[model samples]
Target: MKIFEIVFSPTGGTEKVSGYIADALEGEPVAVDLTDCGLGFRTVAMTKEDVAVIAVPSYGGRVPAVAVERLGMVRGNGARAVLVCAYGNRAYEDTLVELEDAAKGAGFRVIAAVSAIAEHSVVRQFAADRPDAQDAVQLAGFARKIQQKISEGDASEPAIPGNRPYKKAGGTGMVPKATKECTDCGACATACPVGAIDKDDPRRVDKKACISCMRCVAVCPHAARAVNPIMLSAATKMLSKACVDRKECELFI
Candidate 1:
């Protein structure tokens, strides 16, 4: 069956996590970058003969709003899906379950679910250098299990982790402000999935539009953007366990 790896990664962590799973499956992956032009609006049309590994990072215990909006545009046509929610060692909370719902809504039949840990996109200390060697081995094994399940024609939706009511995780709502070094080169604006950054002056981020995925901070050539220091510190402190040096990936069949 044709395999597709659809991902929404701004800081490369989610992409790395998704890649490990895709590699193990030994299926030809169709890569769709959510950050790419018009991807947010265009539909990902697939057929029953295909399999999809849909992966995205958890932004504030939820799917990135832009990704949520964009994923809704896809049409899976009963294609079996393996949903993955990559997080920064912090709790995935509602991410995986919500992702399942979104993928199902997009016409995919949920077959498997995964929650992988990667380096924190916002809090630097957590899951640093993750999806590393240990994670790779585990993910490779996970892939084998999934391959077996698919071969057995087991397409039943598996029990995925997350809260039914979706535990309340407060939104950091940290607006990334551009620093003086910003050249107004417009890279951030162009890269933003929601057009949160102003193209004319990239420094000014429309907080209302920003999803706080930190794409602008990571992609900035000048390292010109930053979130609130106090809030970041508090968050890091609260999520220390999630930041502990845990092996990056785990496999479940």
Candidate 2:
């Protein structure tokens, strides 16, 4: 059976966690990058013998809109799927349940689910240096259990916890701006999934178009992009209590 690693990671955090799980599973999986603006996800098709590892980052306690949209286009064709939700330490809330629904709607048979921690995409301090050594070990253990379940011919659906009407997604109020160090390389413009950054002038950012996924910030080699200091301080203060503690990985099979 073939394995497909389908993921929507604007930054590298979710991708890193997915790599660990896919590697532990038993195949050289084909990668389907959901974050690529150029990809035509509707053309991705699979068979019953195939297994898929679907991963996405939790944005503000919910799945990103772009991810949900792209994932819906994939035709699972009765493929067995393992759902993964990677988030900053604060919470994943309804991400897993929502993902399960999306996968099932796309014709995938839900077999297993996982929730793991990764560094925050927008707020950097939360879950910093995560999917570390400890996370890697736990993720591998989860994969082994999943392998066992499949080997034993288990077809039961995992009971994932979350509310039916998912929490409303908030606005992308914060946008990363270019500093004096910006070289106008156009990398950020090319990499932006939404075309928020102006190609002719990299310094120009369209706030309404930007999802605040931080792809530009992460990809910048110059280390010149950042949000307003006042906004960042307030966000850091708000999330400090919830993110400071260590949150462990969870698995459902």
Candidate 3:
């Protein structure tokens, strides 16, 4: 059976965790980048003999709207799916459940789910250098177990956490702006998953469209993009309690 590693990672954290799990699974998996705005997700088709490791980052305990919209277009065609939600140390409350629902809706049979921790995309200090050695070991174990489940023909839907309605969608409002060092290279614009940055003038960002995923900030060669200092401080304080303690990855079979 073929394996597909489908992921939506803004600042590379989610992608890191997804990579670990995908590597631990059976064969070389085909990659489907949900972050690519140019990708036509609707054209993605999978047969029953395929398995998909669908991974996405948890934005404020919920799935990113852009990811949801793009994932909706994929046709799973009865493929077995393993849902993965990667979040900063805080929490992934509804992400896995929402992803499971989305995969089911897309015609995939949900077999397993995972919640993993990654460095906070905005607050780099929080959960820094995560999916570390410990995380890798745990994720690898989960992958092996999931592979065994698949081999055994276990197609039962796994029980995932979170509510049906889901928490009211929340926003971080931590938009990054270009600093004096900005070279107008347009790298940020090209890398922006939502096309929030204007191509001609990369500095001109559509605040409304920006999810504050920090893709632009992370991709900036000159380190020109950053959120306001005061806002970042306040956000740091707000998340301090939730991020202080190390959170472990959880697997559902």
Q: Best TM-score goes to which candidate?
A: 3
User: For model 2, how does the per-residue alpha-carbon lDDT over 68-138 read when each residue is reduced to its tens digit?
Assistant: 88999999999899999999999999999899999999999999999999999878878899989999998
Per-residue lDDT tens digits of candidate 3, residues 54-92?
999999889998898888899999999988899999989
The CA lDDT at 146 in model 1 is 85
Residue 174's lDDT within candidate 3 is 80
| Superior by TM-score: candidate 2 or candidate 3 | 3
Question: Clashes in model 3: which pairs?
Answer: none
- Model 3 misplacement above 4 A: none
Q: Any residue pairs clashing in model 1, and if so which?
A: none
Model 1 TM-score (2 dp): 0.91
Q: Rank the candidates by lDDT, best first.
A: 3, 2, 1
Model 3: residue 87 alpha-carbon error in angstroms? 0.8
RMSD after Cα superposition, model 3 = 0.9
List where candidate 2 sits over 4 angstroms from the true fold: none
Per-residue C-alpha lDDT of model 1 across residues 1-253, encoded as one tens digit per residue:
6788889998999888888777777556688887775554455688987888889998778887667677788888999888888888867779988888889888899888788888888887788888788887877778788888888888877887677776665554777888888888888888887788888888777887777888888998999889889989987888886567564454434
TM-score to native of every candidate shown? 0.91, 0.97, 0.98
lDDT of each: 0.81, 0.90, 0.91
* Better model by lDDT: candidate 1 vs candidate 3: 3
lDDT of 3: 0.91
